[model samples]
Target: MEVVQVLCMKGGNGDTSYAQNSLLQKKVISLTKPITDEAISNLFCNNFPARLCIADLGCSSGPNTLFAVLEFVTTVDKVHKKMGHELPEIQVFLNDLPGNDFNTIFKSLPTFQKDLQKTMGAGAESCFVTGVPGSFYGRLFLGKSLHFVHSSYSLQWLSQVPRGLESNKGNIYMASSSPPSVLKAYYEQFQTDFSMFLRCRSEELLEGGSMVLTFLGRISEDPSSKECCYIWELLAVALNDMVAEGLVEEEKMDSFNIPQYTPSPAEVKCEVEKEGSFTINRLEASEVNWNAYHEEVFSRYQKIVADRMSREKTEFVNVTVSMTKRG
Candidate 1:
């Protein structure tokens, strides 16, 4: 599929002050720590560098991104303290799409620095955090320069829309009664994106470094289920309504498609194993009831659509996959 970059108007500022704090972000961060600690301990125990370089890929501008990175660093600090060793100088790189709202990220940095200073202490080793904007499929750091990499709520986005859909063979994502074409397109994109991710990370990670990623996913191969996700349906309804109202052309709606894709747990594991560089230490899939937060966020989403779109839609459900990586 020819990848089409849909230019979407920026919606929210990535803040959740008014949204319900289901603590989903906190839980994911907490779950991420033990895996990170284990990997770092194993990779750097004997050859702990004075400085540790880490990258958080697909780090959207928000408290969630900051929270996850802080939790990981704090955990590492505790591990070093328990071992009677001084904490390594930490350097964290936050990465996301080029269009991401960097102002929001930058504004939060002072608070992040203050908390870090308090937790690790002013006399403790220094830790530097900076934002790097780009796609993860490409190079973002110097070769063999990083000790660890982490990404959350990212990677499920296809690098581009799948091709061959005009012929009815189906592409990476489409609105249809049956979703086989959608599934195939998603699988192909994942295969490409996963390969690029490995190739890029391999170039930047030390010989024994590790990576951890969390993303939305599915447990079953069935594509036409409510469990699969309802975002497609909601979008279809919204688009149809807009077409009926002559807000957007019918042809434009036909060409537009969702940029997201959700892989099954088995499919993800297969790709990781096939990559040959990463040793899979853990692969877990779980149902995440974001209902509380969904209720709050979707309400806001509906209002946004109502102003621009012709209809309102319901909340969509999503599954989550957490994976650990080792070189």
Candidate 2:
């Protein structure tokens, strides 16, 4: 399936919407907060821009959206306050696929502005937030425009499904049942997409600029390692369960695969080096247990999954693929 056509965090603020079901993503943002803080702090202390431009790529809508923006703005505000200098005009660019539910974020802006005003007080007035709807795999901003870039639980998503997997057999996304060729396709797609990511950012970021990214990654070189890819296995199980009931075509199941891949830190480093744009100042890997989710939220999520499969099988695949990546 075409990723841009299908890839979206379930929209709106309803139960199945990414807004309601994104606690795991919030945790990722939180887990990476200090790193985020340091990146921004380094930007300011080393050579602070008069007008700071920051982009939150794949910034799906909901609380997590502004939550990241809040952390970024707060980092700059605190650094400026400590330095006793005028705060820079912070331009916050929120990015995601065009299908993302920007309306919720837009509606939340009034409150966000108010909260920022309340939190940062006078300095908050300098921060300007705008939404840019597009893919981050390609150029999204002007040359040397952004200072600090943040993307959490995203980047795992490939720009599209891998090529030449028409007969991958009964599996979806880096599963043990997948053959070596299938796994290779996933890795190649990641290498391409990630190289593009670093390449594009290299152009957009100023010298001495930095980026803090957190996404699902494997501790093992093996693609079938549970840490690397159990969620998709479970999702395939869920869909196969539906197939047992004749709700979906087996052919659909065979053809359908998630447009996402998790890389090991070594793989990430290799691609970053191969791209030869940005230096790897740091690389850290963390894991979140699959059972960390509350049962109530998961039940709602499962219902949405079944509904999406019934409505548009690949649509369910697309959204839940994103959800599991975040988790």
Which candidate should be chosen as best, given lDDT against the real structure?
A: 2
lDDT of 1: 0.66
Residue runs of model 1 more than 4 Å from their true location after superposition: 1-27, 123-125, 167-176, 291-327
The CA lDDT of each predicted structure is: 0.66, 0.77
Best by TM-score: 2
Worst 10 residues of 1 by lDDT: 2-11
lDDT of 1 by residue, 1-327 (tens): 333233222424534441124256556656556666676666556676888898988776667767777776887788777778777788889987777766777888889888877887863347778889778878999999988888766777777766545432221144355346655765687789878888889889887778877666666676444444555554456556666788767776666666666766677778777877777776776555433223433554465445533443333233333333443
Give the residue spans of candidate 2 off by over 4 A: 291-327
> Tens digit of lDDT per residue, candidate 2, span 122-182?
8878988899999998899999888888888888888999997876767777777778888
CA lDDT, candidate 2, residue 278: 68
Model 1: number of backbone collisions: 2
